[model samples]
Target: MTILVMGATGAQGGAVARRLVAEGHSVRGFGRSGEVPAGVEPVTGPLEAALDGVSHVSLVLPMLLERAEVDRWVEIVAGSGVRRVVFNTANRIPPAATDVALFESRRAASDALLASGVPTVVLRPPVYLDNLRAPWVAGRLAAERVLSYPLPADLPVAWISHDDLAAATVAALTRDGLEDDVLDIGGPASLTGPQLAAAFGATYEAQDVAAFQEGLTHAFGPEVASVVAATYHWLAKHGGDLYETDPTAAERLGIRFTPVHEWIAA
Candidate 1:
């Protein structure tokens, strides 16, 4: 089957494409610049043009974009005769109760798919573990020798690994009987900011969580600090685990989920 992947050059899409190719499937990746993995075919043009002859599609659209573009993409894909679709959605959206702008946009897209009669699956994943490598974490690791963020010490979070997300996506793409459903993928265990800090400290000789948070503020500014703080605050008050055990993912993918610390080490 020929699968067309949107955002093929990005982290999630790239991992999905690589995994599919490793399993011996033909993949055509659609991207703005038409750049893709070495084994996959890189197709030029917009999402609409890339939909031709595509049996399955994986949508990993950009976040925090205008709603119009999101709607347009969905409209085009729905009309394109693509049978199966996997949409990457956000786990947490702003304003909590109301649909997050980004997730709302994706929900709209999912609606379009349903209205068009295409089989669709939504994958809602939380903040990735690889986010630690971002300037917020890396710069702090380099400069302050501390791991600091606005998130409270005891707040627990399930930080999913990108590799695990990719594996789950592959399972969704290849499996049957998963139409019009939402799957929340999370890490195997939930850990607090201090725990993550401890993990890093164990890895790097002189680093700690205070340094991480400090570095995050330094690299991302106060807005990020506020966001991180809010996330932890909500988690603490909510008192629910972000980590979920998905036997479905494991059964379909034939692999165990990756743990947060193991992913960080990798």
Candidate 2:
């Protein structure tokens, strides 16, 4: 039962690939960059060739893909005879459609996958703890000892780490009786901006959405940055809702999320 992992070169997917390999699973890694973890095999040719002999798949779609292109890829994955799929939506689904292209596109892709009757599980992860390592956030924290973010000061977020996310993805893929289920995975604690900064022993500073957007634009081209920034803009308007509300989800899924201090120290 070989598992095919998409975007294995990326942080999230790389973590998953490594964990799966550590567990002694047969892993076939697929990424545009043609890179995979040491134990995993990389696929440099067509996706179908990589899909061969695969029983399950870990799908991680890129954020910059257009709706039509996303639809095309979803169609292909749905047609593939894979037994199950663990799809990382990469963002929390909004209560209703908003102007944020990323959320809408993810929702669309998730709906298509579920509608495909592929016995899929969708994982909606909030802000990644690993994102703190990004130059914009890390630079400020290191040089000025301030943790700056565009989120509201009081808004609580269950920030998740890539390792925790990888563990959740593994459970979603290997566990049974989870077909067609949607999960919102998060860290052990839900923290506000001040609380999160305190964990890092740094001061919390609320950054303007425009400035945050500008920083993102510099990191990941303008198009991807715009959509990501739009999500924060929406969050600024809609506060007090990013944390995980499902109290029993972690215990039920057998996932133990890592703490902020542990993540930061690592």
Candidate 3:
């Protein structure tokens, strides 16, 4: 089956496309920049043409998670013979009862999918272990053997990898009877900051929310830092273990999640 993958050049979308291709499926990408993974075809025309004989679609929206774009994409793919949609909300427990702008945007995106008349399966993945690969985060680990990030020390987070997310997404794309389902794509288990650091053979250094903002400012620019700092502050203050391992979902989806230690070792 041919799969139309939006954001196919991105980290998550690229991972999904590679997994699907490795499973012997045709993959097409609908992205503006960057190259799609080696075996995937890059779509360069209208959505109507792109959807011709397409079996499924995987969307990776921007951080803003605009609702209008969500509605627009779904509207085009609704009757285009696309059998399914696998949307990554980049959040584990979305639509939380909150006035936060990020949550509001993600909630709107999720609502748009449900209302768009498409057979959609939403995967809300929590904090990715891949975040450890970020330059700013990794630099600390490499230089001082310290894992420094914004999340509170006591917080237990279900850290997942983009690879695990890709596996789950591929299962969703090829399978059926998951029309309006929402799955929390978490890791094998939850880990605290120190526990996560211990996997890297590093010492855990919890950063102050303010210090995190400063570090982000130094790594990225002010505009990016301001937008990111809000979420970090929220996590440091109130973020809890919003999602846990759903073993039944994993078994049903035919996904074997990677644990933190396993990923670290690899």
Candidate 4:
């Protein structure tokens, strides 16, 4: 099967493309610069041109954009005879909180993909473990010796590793009989904000959530701050079940999901 991976320069797409190549499949990476791992074909063009000769596609587009772009991409891919797709969607976008732009955008994309007459599987991964490496945690670890972010201290989040998300995406792309499925993939263990802070304290100092957010705003700007705040509000009000794992996909793929700390250590 020939697979075309969108956003191949980004984390999830990059990992998925690499894994597919390692498995000896014909993989083509589509992105702005066509920067892909060695041994993979790089296609530089818009989504329409990239859809040619592609039997399957893995979409990892940005989550904060206008929904129309996603719809258009899906239309192009479907029109081009792409039969299967694996969408990296956001788990936090519940029907009740459709007002959040990021979540709404991802939800729109998922809907578009499903309605595009193509077999599709959507993987909704939770907060990534690598998100901790953002300047919010890095600065906190450097100065205050702590890791903090907005959210109730006791709110538990099922943070999945990006590597695991990639693995799940690969499984969805390569496996059969999983079309039109939506799977929430997360880590084996869930940790509360305070619990995660304590875990970080084992290796670095523990800082307050306010300080972390403040540093994050400085590092990432106000738009990111608003998104983070909205995400924390969703977690606090609706809880972390948004990103909860079902284990079916992992079991079917025969790959154990990586734990949060284990990924962090790596």
Q: Pick the candidate with the highest TM-score.
A: 2
Candidate 3's error at 262, in angstroms?
1.0
Off by over 4 Å in 1: 93-96, 142-145, 150-152, 202-255
Task: Please report, as a residue range, the 10-residue window in candidate 3 with the lowest summed lDDT.
Answer: 92-101
Local distance difference test, each candidate = 0.69, 0.86, 0.79, 0.73
Cα lDDT for residue 247, candidate 3: 63
How do the candidates rank by lDDT, highest first?
Answer: 2, 3, 4, 1
Cα RMSD (Å) between model 2 and the true structure?
A: 1.4
TM-score of each: 0.78, 0.95, 0.90, 0.86
Over the stretch 1-266, how does candidate 3's per-residue lDDT look in tens digits?
A: 78998878888888998998899988998776748999999986577887888888897776543557666766676657567888887775434566555666666666777777778888888788888889879998999999998888778888899899899899888776778888877887878889888889888877888887887789787866777777777777678666456666676677789888888888
Q: Is candidate 1 or candidate 4 better by TM-score?
A: 4
**Residue 147 shift from truth in candidate 4, angstroms:** 2.1
Residue 244 miss distance in model 3 (angstroms): 3.4
Error of 3 at 9 (Å): 0.9
TM-score of 3: 0.90
Q: Is candidate 1 or candidate 2 better by TM-score?
A: 2
Sort the predicted structures by TM-score, highest score first.
Answer: 2, 3, 4, 1
lDDT leader: 2
Q: Which ten residues in a row have the lowest lDDT in candidate 1?
A: 202-211
Off by over 4 Å in 2: none
